[model samples]
Target: MAATAEKVKRGRKFAQVLEGARQVFLRDGYEGANVDEIAREAGVSKATLYNYFPDKRLLFLEVAKAECQRQADEAVEFDDGSAPPDRVLFAAGRRIADFVVSDFGQGVFRICVAESDRFPEIGQEFYRSGPGLVRRRLADYLREAVARGDLEIDDIDLAADQFAELCKADIQTRRVFRLPGCRSGETLDRIVRGAVEMFMARYGVKKGQTKA
Candidate 1:
């Protein structure tokens, strides 16, 4: 299993096939992803794609893992740990909101949900790379904030999870329920601010504290 997984990640055509699989799985999902469509998307022949991945499930899992890692790396790179809790939380919330409403995020989320029962590894990989990683990073910052007296929390993990939900819950439902079109950036900002305010109200060290 490990050997095949490594082979799937390496090779000249692996990058091409991975990107193609990412798109097709996001759009058509696990059960719906077609080999031919993925090949066409990659601008490669079916024979070439098969050289990297013989199993469709393996291909999809690799794609999900790659994409989630890509997003997580970007998040970590831009993250400012020295910032105040409110500022940090707001930034986290904004990033969550942006992804929740994005086409890629929504599609990947659906794939994880739809295939969780059948392909547990795919869902698990997605969580580890995406939400799990994000939550851990948030928890680390929350712990730091608590030490610095910026915030108070008994369970950093729970609070981190709660803050994450708070970021997208208010507005993500519309998208989850298949609401038409994209959400406006202004609307996303409003909800992110509201989430940060609510979180700070519960844990903030200062009263009437504004974002720093």
Candidate 2:
């Protein structure tokens, strides 16, 4: 009973500290935020914060992880009804494009890029939370399409990676550098549509094209 209670207490304590750290990181950014301030905001002693996170770098990494996870969760709900596989790809690409160009996505990108070099593990964590999972999800969908005869690809995993790259276009660079008036929405639509069509032409079974 005592051990169980202790575990629950520690879990709650970690949650509280994580929430506080996110607010501090968002307000002051990774470079400006301090451990003591985070601890104070979390209603824990500096020692307590250390007991949970060990260092500010790890704490910030966790914050990025949480943000990416939230975005990935949102990707779960994209129902564009039954359509041509490539057309569906275009729609999914545009949805992700809008999200990446949004204010919240830009903020997450900034935080991750600013802190990624300082703590390389944080980069891995962020990738796992976002792009890594996205790639895996795409691969799974492609494999399913293959089974259903909707698409044809020799290597599902590689195809999935290429598909995601098709979606990304130059959006990341535009967002990171804050390029003046980057194309989004319908403009993004044209770019992603072209890219998806090109990708499908290369990998997917074209209409009337013989399967290799």
Candidate 3:
């Protein structure tokens, strides 16, 4: 969320390598991604790729960090106006759900879990940049919604967490394990909409349609 986490040697091919890494990492995941594929995707030689990123793990970490930053930057803050709570929450839920099911998002979580024993800070940093940031911003939005009489919640933070969890219902775990046919577009739409409906039932002052 701050500066790029990894300190790889940078050169003309730095961005090129990263772009290739991003594609391969997102396509095949960290363990499945081969260095040669990344190099080929980036149109660089193996020696050039190694020169920029000595360790494949570091390269993956850098990609994960960039992803988190990208999500943070793209996250919407609905504090400036009176966007309907239902619409706002649905948008947030959709964004979260989409990322959670995405290959990049899966990679970020997997790397954090796999490296937790060796590098605890990696997990912590991911939390700060990813889930933690989402919770904070969502809580802020919920607090404002309550003030606007759009929602009824005793605990904004808890509500934020609940909504986030609701978005992942029956989606994250299945997708994480690569279960077949778990990522149908229609199925994801149902899950995200269901999450918003449940949250609104609990907190919405007046239930409203969240369908797009």
Backbone clash numbers for all candidates listed: 0, 0, 0
For residues 111-187, write the lDDT of model 2, one tens digit per residue. Answer: 77776777666567667767777677677777777776777789888887787777777876787687866554666
User: lDDT at 175 for candidate 2?
Assistant: 71
Give all TM-scores, in the order shown.
0.87, 0.70, 0.81
Q: Which candidate is the best by TM-score?
A: 1
Whole-model lDDT values for every prediction: 0.80, 0.72, 0.80
Find the 10 residues in a row with the least total lDDT in model 1.
72-81
Once superposed on the true structure, which residue ranges of model 3 sit more than 4 Å away at CA? 1-7, 25-34, 206-212
Model 3 Cα lDDT, one tens digit per residue, 69-153: 7867876555444678778877888888888888768877776776678657667877877788989999888877777677789
Which pairs of residues have clashing backbones in candidate 1? none
Cα deviation at 18, candidate 1, in Å, is 1.7
Q: Where does candidate 1 stray beyond 4 Å?
A: 1-3, 6-10, 76-82, 180-182, 207-212
Looking at model 2, which ten-residue stretch has the lowest summed lDDT? 1-10
Whole-model alpha-carbon lDDT for candidate 3: 0.80
Among residues 3 or more apart in sequence or in different chains, the pairs in candidate 3 whose N, CA or C atoms overlap within 3 Å are none
Candidate 1, residue 161: how far the Cα is off, in Å:
1.6
